[model samples]
Target: MPGYGYVSEEQRGVVLLSDDAVIPQVINDRLVTAFASVTITNANVTGQEILPIHTADSQGPRGDESGWIQVVSARATCSEGIQIKIVLPVHFSIKLAPGQTYPVPLNLSIEGDNAPKSMRIHLDLADLGNTKRWTVSTGEYELERREWGSAYKITFLDYDHSVHYAMAFPPEGNCEQWPEKRCPVVLALHGAGVEASSSYWTESYRRQKNAWVLFPTGRTPWGYDWHGPSFWNIESALDALRLRPGVPDDLVNSVGVNRERLIYAGHSNGGQGAWWLLSHYPDRALAGLPAAGYVKIQFYIPYFMRIGDAYADPLLRGILESAISEHDIDLYASNMAGIPILARTGGSDDNVPPVHSRRLIRMVNEWSRKTTAANLSEIPNQGHWFAGVVDDDVMQSFVDTSLQNASTQGLSLPALPSAFSLSTLNPASSGSKGGIRILQLQVPFRLGTIRVHRQNDQWILNTTNVRRFGFVADDRQEGLQRWSVDGTNFDKPPVVSGKSYLKGEDGIWKVADDMLWISEERHFSTYGPAIHIFDQPFIIVIPSTITERTITYRKMAQHLATSWYLFGRGGTQIVRDVDVLDGIAAQYNMLVLGGPEDNMFTKKRQPGLESMVKFLPGGGFQIDKRVYVDQGTGILFLAPSPTRTRMGLFIAGTDADGLLRAAWTVPFRTGLQVPDYIVLGEEYGDPSTGWTAGDGAPFGGAGTKGAGGVLAAGYWSNHWDFDARCGYLK
Candidate 1:
């Protein structure tokens, strides 16, 4: 075998290590590594030339290195045509032109050890040659190039890290020189299965002229209607994009985006999200276009068929219903009466019924007889996707007309039409855009409503389920010189402090920064035992004693970090209990991983743990004098952090077996059945197999004998006070 040769298997092609790789915005040159394996057919292979080809004919060499691609390294091996590998590391020095997709196709040239430069032979391996391609892009303008968008891992201090991807398209024309010219912004949301970073879902909007389109990953691949923490993820992505490099400064400045012309649009799940965002934060968007979106989760996905709906207890049902009500878009449809909305649904869609959209329109029209009815358009025989529905001229006309109308209305909140009603859940003061000056809520995802009317020189506010609320007013507004509140307990005349009017003596006009607000960052903090340990920035604390179970927990932590990085990109640090510095507890939530016997931190916090669940001396766990001892138990609960008023989640097992069980249950896959607080028993299943209720809880007397042995799965009060009424026990 004198000549160089490469082999290709019939069934497989050259392995492309980085498939659909995204290039994030970077100020300096970046190294991109791609791997492939080339098997030697019969000859000894020495070196290989990896060439990068541009897919587009329009992309030619500029005068400089801007269009040139340099291969930094190409290391290869030769074997029995069976197994050989190569590493191709390329250094991309040129800045990719902003708002363009560069698909780089790779080609390889193989050479024998003694072959002359003139005798080099290029073989297109069936596996590697023409099959591998990489899409590289720069800047966050538009959703046309998905590979250019990188998944960002946002870490919340004392909370978990969230992974989200976002892309921003540049505005048309040269706006940088003319800083006064502002562009309209469209916040686009993706459907359920679509990744936030996928370009396919955002490609249609690229056709819109002179507009800046933002596609946010919405935290998880399948987020829950973009509520709670997911809502914050959208905000965080917007903030990051505003400061990101390569974005034109004029396009991001105060004058760059016509905030008054902001439009929200989504398809399927994102359609539902558009409705959710519009109704909850009515003043944020000037108009909304929700295409093929379901009204609520219960209506979108049947809850009657779900496992949780089988419960018969009135208290349990009430608690579950209350939680579900937070996401019911129809319940808040009345809030959309004043906002300009154009909802669409496919006539032949099977995923989400079209009636949901019709029902929403009807509700909004009925709620506000004074305002014009929100429009609805049905595309005959169209499916759930936005492709056919959004492409319709009617839909495009609606969007353009809405944007033009909003531009004339200016950037402030439009005056509420007569006899208007608004509802909100976890309303933040920051989201108040239009200066409607009605009410702001403090609680997270707690429904609150206000019916307001202006008469002469006073504004009357009829409120419901609003414990902590405030009103904002501009000195320039004429009729609403005074506000009269009806629902809340604040009966006395409001005291004027600064620009806000505080209700009664105890009411503070400032935003309420409490446990409820903190819970929004991490839902498990609100009512725990079932806390999301991975969502917040947390430190795992290990005790001095190193038992077999301790080692298991350490490995579990490593596995969790690896898995999290595999899914997105972020990891938490683990430290010894003794190594924890003095204020560390205040900065990060602690995940104590051992039992009270071995973990000193857990031992020190035993006094506080006694109030929630007590460990019996004879051998079992005790909650309110109910003892469970037969099976080894694992306990998980959330309490006030010993260092501060923040939250701390403690996971400890009765012994080595219990600790091991708790480790496997921390991840959501196997922990979905484990609620706020759980006492796991000896019975267990493979972690690969989903959760089984029998494997956890009610091992002894704590749970009902006939019922699934869930010992304790309920939430504590907002103040960390023990309340039997707040949660349901087995």
Candidate 2:
């Protein structure tokens, strides 16, 4: 149910449209800011406030304002003959003859006095101010690998418009170790009810380095987001997994698993989504593996489906009908002819009948011998429940694809050296996304001690040292803060702890071993007066020790060259300064490291960025404060600003509260436009909120060898702060 407004008894004859007022928007799925209050004059007595409530939860206080909210009921108010004005997120414009105060029908229900529960009400612009804003978290997931000493690297691919996804690389790195590089990946899908953001399942899959998995959410035409569908959005999402800042460019393109070396899989709604994506995107995989899913679309009928037939289900049926009522079945059939499909279904599956999948497969194979060759596997005793019998075979085989089928379905990582420990964290990504792990502590190894591992293909930072962590403000960079790891000298022996704990190594999320400190000064300016006072920005620079360094960097250049051609995902134009993952993204395209001045252009990123102008078209790495990069190669687009009507009407011009960017002037919505130049080094504090660094603000990392302050060249940072890490090994 949607959230509506609260009414008070004192204003019986008057309507209160402010303060926690839940004015529902008229447009489907469109949200409106909530209002604070609305007053009505010449009203009756009785001053009482009523809030949103649910009559089904329990009794006595049925009409009490204690409950959260129930947006469906228009007659929820207490008074029977009271008149009130309700504000809506949508404004109704009337076009009468000329000068007329046309009475608009408002959906305010009062038993008999014209207080209709559902009417389109006429409202003024001033009656709005109560938009509900809730907190949403896109929690982080740790990458995993089974092998030791492996530079953790993994590529991810997701498709939601056609299928739901949630995948991760093994806990280990995917890059070339002293002996090897280039890791394998897995295709993971989600079930019904949960989105890709859910850590419960994603973490489970994130613990493997041998394979990488992909995750995506479903979308509905009538709903605000997605329900399930694949290829439609999968292409772009896969592109993002490869294009995200900080990944090794060379390794990014390698993530698109060898078509012949992949396994297709899914669960529940995603189960059907998987089948659809496989049938739709012929080049997506080598084998099909869906659990708790139907054998065909026929099984999706309500009487048998667990979620019931979405086509028959009130909510999804409407969505399904509206979304594909005009689509052609041949489109899906033609796409399925080239690939080998392996359908895994539960005999008793209810959400999706085993029969639906069975029928769909039969239908596809009916007309073509090549398509009919596809295989279908069913679990004997399994049903609609999520647990299945093939997790090991499917996952393990995906990891060992090269070894198992080295010829037709093999993908090998660069040869890696045997397990080895780092000499120091300074040169490794252990301290940041761009570097590697730190040195291993000597002696006094603690038992049951904990270690923290990073997400994606990052190394672990050893925290066994006696060093204490703290955040320090650069008297130089006014608001920026950087973490320092100190206390135990290189000569001190390691301390002892209770149990062995691995933050990213053992599991997706492990407990923190030691206390972490952060100072209020997190965001810093590049050339700000605050940092200037400290003499200069003093950041601990890590060594460039990535394997296949030149090869990797070159690959990065290539990835950048063709990034725009890559389909899927949102935003375009390169404009953020970030770390270069030598072997990863560098392998896919050429990456250019523009100077640090990219962080200051919060309003207009396109101005004065000569490097972006040169690098974008040249297909090289360019960095700046702009939101997107690689428009020349792929669709990493910077989403456009919100519609003008939704602009914040604040007295101050710099309110810059809109999500994504602070710029009020937006490029009118146009077809996906690609630019020949690049700029995107200045990273936003949060993508949802367009927080950027001030002009001339430093990137806040290690500067060139001799440069004293933070502004020196060679120092790098995507955002405003530095991350200090502590962890345990063995």
Candidates in order have lDDT scores of: 0.50, 0.28
Looking at candidate 2, the ten consecutive residues that score lowest on lDDT are 644-653
For candidate 1, the per-residue lDDT at 79 reads 30
lDDT of residue 415 for candidate 2: 19
lDDT, candidate 1, residue 655?
66
What lDDT score goes with residue 728 in model 1? Answer: 53
lDDT of 2 by residue, 370-414 (tens): 445555667666676544333546544543543344323234221
Indicate the residue-level lDDT of 253 in model 2.
Answer: 41
Per-residue lDDT tens digits for candidate 1, residues 1-730, read 1121333323121222233322232211211111111111111112121111222111233222122221112322233231222232222211111111122222222333221111111123211122222221111211121122232221111114322346565554432322245666677888876876555665656545555677776655665456644555667656544443344234345325544346788888888888887776676666788888888876766655544334334455544345346467887776776777888998888988789889888887787674356888888887777465644677778766765564454443444666667675434312332244333332333456777775665666776654444444433244445556663333243332323332433543333433343432322233333434433456666665655454456454445444443432333444556655546665666677665666677777778778677766643567665665654566666665665434566777666556655666654321133444555555442223224433334434322221133345555544454457545554
lDDT of 1 at 693: 36
Q: Give residue 454's error in model 1 in angstroms.
A: 3.9
